[model samples]
Target: MEFVILTGLSGAGKTNALHAMEDSGYYCVDNLPPLLLETFYDLCDNSTDNRMKKVAVVADARSGEMFADIPEVISKLRLEGKQFKILFLDAKPNTLLVRFKGTRRKHPLIGEIASGSIEEAVELENELMNGVKAMADYVIDTTFMNPNELMERVTTLFSAGAHDTLLVTCVSFGYKYGLPPEADMVLDVRCLPNPFYIKELKPLTGLDEQVRNYICGFDVMGEFLDHLYAFIDYLISLYRNEGKSELVIGVGCTGGKHRSVTVARMLNTHLLENGQKSAIHHRDIWKA
Candidate 1:
């Protein structure tokens, strides 16, 4: 199992990093207490299922007094031969102050725990976390980074097979429901024949062999896919050269259940066949 502990300043975007890790297929837990670190690792380690192979937990100032135990726990794990990495996030004090002010959220060290201004709280937290920070395998200064950039950084550091390849996500959607906001490229498959009109195929999805056959039966379908595959192959090369870490391709038709799903699946297969890393998701498949 690959275990990762995420820690950092209160306003330094640790939550955003955790969300990014979750999106990258890691089983993530936020605000995990330091005392439970070994217990959590044991649970994940002894699991028969493979889903726990990658786990990330956030241990920050929110753990209060328990936060002090983090460094010791990390040392124990290391001594016991448990493999893990620490990711520490930090930002300039001014940037952290601005973030806290803009969000109007109280600093974790304020009130009864530590009586002072936000600046003092930030400084104190930094001092308390300095030990953990020194042990980090990766430290990200997020003062100038936006959420997207931070996510890319986190994914690049922790995602499997992400070192030398771009991650491609193919989304199947219905135009009527609106375009996916994150799409890098949108392909309209509405021009293809609609299987919803056919009484027999109406209830079936693109995954069904009959629906797949019907969609591929059209000459135009073959022609479109041929050109589409060639274009995407060229585009992927360009994107890789440009250092693009991720790409989202959207395929849309009247409804997401049929044509869009079929086309997205075809695109995903084509990408895999060409040695590209890709994932397919039918966004509106079960919508009424």
Candidate 2:
């Protein structure tokens, strides 16, 4: 079983990391006592009905006296051949202070912080947590990163693949509505003849063959697809070498009712057929 032990300085984004791990399919436990570490693992292993579970434990100084035993326990666990990794989340002292002040929580190291001072408390905690931080296999700075950025990093590090491919997030939007701010590539399908204009095909979307043929009927359409395919291949090569986790591609038409939706669906299928890990979103489809 793959196990991850998560510990970090207070206000350094441990909770956020836990949330992200949960999203990435880790069975997460929050604020677990250090002494219970082996007991928990034993319970998991000894259960007759217990299935193989990927486990993550969020541990910190809040375990009070039990926190002192973690290092020895970790050492013992390693000697016994446990499969585990430790990720320590940390941030700048100033950043942690701001986060604490904004939330207004008592520092984990109770008597250390100067009375009514965020800066003093931050420095004191950093000194105390240094030993724990030193033992981490990976340390992440979360000062400027949002949840999505953190999650992307975790997924990229954990994904079962020999090569890291560019993650393309393709969203189909409508010009009448608004463009998705997150798209890395945007293709305008407004110039493609509107299948909505046709009385017979009005009710159907680009998922329909007739609408797809109509959109691809123009000579420019063929050229567009040819260049688009090449561009995607080039991007995959560029990003995999650079260790990029995800990419976003947006396909927009006038209403997102017909042509753009069709193209986005087709592109999604084409990418899959070419052996890419990809997903698609029709942003404005329900609106129309």
Candidate 1's clash total is 0
Error of 2 at 139 (Å): 1.2
Where model 2 places Cα greater than 4 Å from the true spot, the runs are 48-52, 111-116, 159-288
lDDT of 1 by residue, 1-288 (tens): 888889999988998899999988888888899989999999999998788878899999998888998889999998998877788898879889999999999999886344569988888898999999888766666765678767876775666732447767777888887776557889999899999999999999888989999989989989999999999989999998986656779899987899999999999999988888887677788888
User: Using alpha carbons, what is the TM-score of model 2?
Assistant: 0.53
Question: What local distance difference test score does each model get?
Answer: 0.84, 0.73
User: In terms of lDDT, which candidate is strongest?
Assistant: 1
Candidates' RMSD to native: 11.5, 9.8
Over 45-129, each residue of candidate 2 has an lDDT whose tens digit, in order, gives 6666424366779888787657777788888887997766777778777778888888989877666444856677677667656
Residue pairs in clash, model 1? none
Candidate 1's C-alpha runs over 4 A off are: 112-115, 161-288
